[model samples]
Target: MTSLPEDPSPMLNEADRDTAVQRLQQAYAEGHIPHEDLDERLHQILTARTRADLVSPLASFPEEEDAGTAFTIAAAGGRIKRQGAWRVPRTLKVESAYARVHLDLSRAVIEHPVIDIELQLGTGKAKITAPRDAIVDFEDLHTGWKDTLYKPPRRSVSGGPTIRISGTMGYGRLKIRHARR
Candidate 1:
């Protein structure tokens, strides 16, 4: 094995990388960093070499509360849509009774390896477009009338995050699809 003389710091293991990623997500959840910052830091965390190199990626966030943040989006009678470089929280709860909800993550910045979305909807359609390599799970979802429309990817992407969905839909359709590469 070859070693660099200028840097003798120990290399990072998978566990170290995972921890750093968690810290980054927590920071974003607490509003310490924006979506763009999270994207950059996520790339840095995933590509860092040594433990010392992890500093800059996990630098900004301080523990404000005991837990990370969860977002709740509620709508009444119109359409709820999010797309184009939006921020995705670690946990999201979408509530609606008569609104068309659309969440497009194909161009969003997602740093965490897992995101949970809970939906409570009635009489409105919901559509979600995930990243090209993401894995979406609707196993915990229950629909009142129509079934959810989701087709799994033909091949899985290694290291891709999992999007878990759990909720109750009433007389509305839930559509989940992946982005084109």
Candidate 2:
């Protein structure tokens, strides 16, 4: 006899199953997932009776539309980082004081054509790595006791979204760069 999981997943309805199947098919068509993964996830989703059983199969897929959180990442003298394969919301606000923050969007899932990032930092360091084709605009960003100077070697391509960063940073360091494709 075997024991059950601590938290059993709730059973899935027909609509939920249909949505999952459609997401898998769309991901496959967009080349987000390989052929093997598409086949495996389709099988898993078909056989999955509960929502929790679909976790592993849909792990590599991006979240559905409006699935990203809308809350700001607030920190006080702490470290905050958003790296690797993560979802990036359209509008993001980061507030911190004496904290170290790093945001790497090299392998992120961006679902918008324009992204707005408002950073309010005080006495700390922040590093943002955007996609190579992304256009970063910080002209309206103000700094006290230090200036935010950003000069890219080359112009941004007409591919990725335009990232607009505006806020006030006091005596802190801000580094922004475009990651290679």
Candidate 3:
């Protein structure tokens, strides 16, 4: 990991670099990095040559220790539901087969502005109920199921966490819904 000078005027281009810089800024705002270190990292990000170069500067950023709170529900042939008030981690992985899984994030205590949901299902139903203000991104999810109730966001939205849904839905139904409030 090569170091760079702290100069705001450093040259930058690629979109990935921009996103990395924004993540660093978010971490700094969360007090994960001090002012001096952030400035140095920001400079490195600005002048980074490859994606791997940008990654090194962010390696020191603190990861959420609350990942243990992430809800991982695997049902072979039953109903699995995560409702009521719960802690929403930075990543939520769900694996289901011949079962029904429901994730209720309306009353969840979200600790980040971005959440990743990895879904792997087979011949079952998986439903995610989140707050109406949430920005659900399921563009990368490909399901062989014909009756999916997911409605991909038509436009960009903010003011809430961006729920990124990925992985395979298998021969199951996946739905992205909102809480009734």
Candidate 4:
């Protein structure tokens, strides 16, 4: 009787290992792989003994280089442009350590049709601005300061949209401004 060959490919080259892992994670996030199966496969890949062991499954997805960035935007059905009416999902989350993010939506139309503008921060500061009518909702605002003159300015327009700002700040400030009608 003849013995069949075992599957190989999980044993990828050192340079390609990280890329493979990232691709797997992306696939999992995209719902291409089932959760249970992904977990099992990931375990196998991590314990892979040789490059040949990693070739089979890795071939299922397209090969690509890894782009290093902590924050990732998965805008499936939204129009992101330089100038125009901008309509994004109400829930916006800025997580982890972000040194600074300046958003200027002066020329864009912002409608608060969603629930709230969520901003979750770990470290650093973020500055966001929109039309005066835009609603700003901050769930948790934490400024890690004992006593200082610098305080996040909060403003709202009369008979206009509302602005909500909520998040934790570590010695940082949040400023909100509305367009003059």
Candidate 5:
């Protein structure tokens, strides 16, 4: 079964942080927190490395939820593409059979710093186009005839989402590349 990352930080996307910020602003407007405290909390929320870091600041506010949740795509002898301003989930499961899977995250909303992509491909191709600053990890991928057109990051990166791609492929190909600026 495909699963979430060991740490849930990757699940807290920019929208989540923005929600927390709005909550903080609301609290400040209502005099729930002092100006100094609000400023400090906002800083923390902006630089939060993990979801837990946003909890304390947003403790008094109700959690802002997104129903989009985990994004799942399945293609059976068809093609699938993800692009534009769609919300990114902590976990993404993609299954393709004699089809093509295209994931473009250049302008997509990213929730987690370490996004996990579970791919189940068969006689197909999975192509992912990510931001230039983003990193692609395929160490756990189990496939046949793998081809990557871009230079993979050497190590885990900060400030941008790191896509961790993994899964089974039968006579399929996987490609990870940076989006054209």
Candidate 6:
């Protein structure tokens, strides 16, 4: 006999309900959902009591769907660190003010053929780094800075992975550094 994955419906909570509704609204505005359907689904989601109930209506948006192929990490006035295995799509977005955003792509997979980064800050900064044994592809690169610093170095690792970042930065600095294994 084979074991099946456990259902996640029991994990749904009040907070999840709120988040799901917000995402649904955003999807509607982004044209991911039609107005009539949005109205019907939003009502159901608001009254949903389980994870399965909440997620059933969201099937139209794949869990891995990258609406804009963009992943965002933002800190308004503090520091934020995101590590572990992650999926990188076509675009990455970071926005902060007096804060920092760091992406440690030591065990991440870059699936997009062309990766782009777009960052905006009021008085904050952003950083994206990869592990030593990673492989990166940077054929299409675009970065912008406004009243801030943007620093990315060029180097190679003997047995480390590579991270290719192509994006924009506004009003802040972006520093790309290497992670020590």
Query: 19-38 in candidate 1: lDDT tens per residue?
Result: 67877886786578999898
lDDT assessment of candidate 4: 0.50
Identify the candidate with maximal TM-score. 1
Report the C-alpha lDDT of model 5 over 52-110, residue by residue, as the tens digit.
Answer: 78777767643443435666888787888889998878889988778888899989987
Residue 149 lDDT in candidate 1:
95
Q: Candidate order by lDDT, highest to lowest?
A: 1, 2, 3, 5, 6, 4
- Please report the TM-score between candidate 4 and the true structure: 0.40
Per-candidate clashes come to 0, 0, 0, 27, 2, 16
lDDT of each: 0.83, 0.79, 0.75, 0.50, 0.75, 0.61
Per-residue lDDT for 69-127 in model 6, tens only?
A: 45676677787677788776566666676777777675666543345565555555666
Candidate 4 lDDT over 45-163, as tens digits, reads 67666766566555565434222212233222222123345544344455445455444555555433432444444444455655655554554455664211222335544433454
Better of 2 and 6 by lDDT: 2
Q: What TM value does model 6 have?
A: 0.42
Task: Please list the residue runs of candidate 6 whose C-alpha ends up more than 4 Å from where it truly belongs after superposition.
Answer: 1-69, 131-172
Q: Between which residue pairs do clashes occur in model 1?
A: none
Error of 3 at 181 (Å): 3.0
In terms of lDDT, which candidate is stronger, 2 or 3?
2
Model 2: lDDT equals 0.79
Candidate 3 lDDT (Cα, whole model)? 0.75
Better model by lDDT: candidate 3 vs candidate 6:
3
Give me the candidate number with maximum lDDT: 1
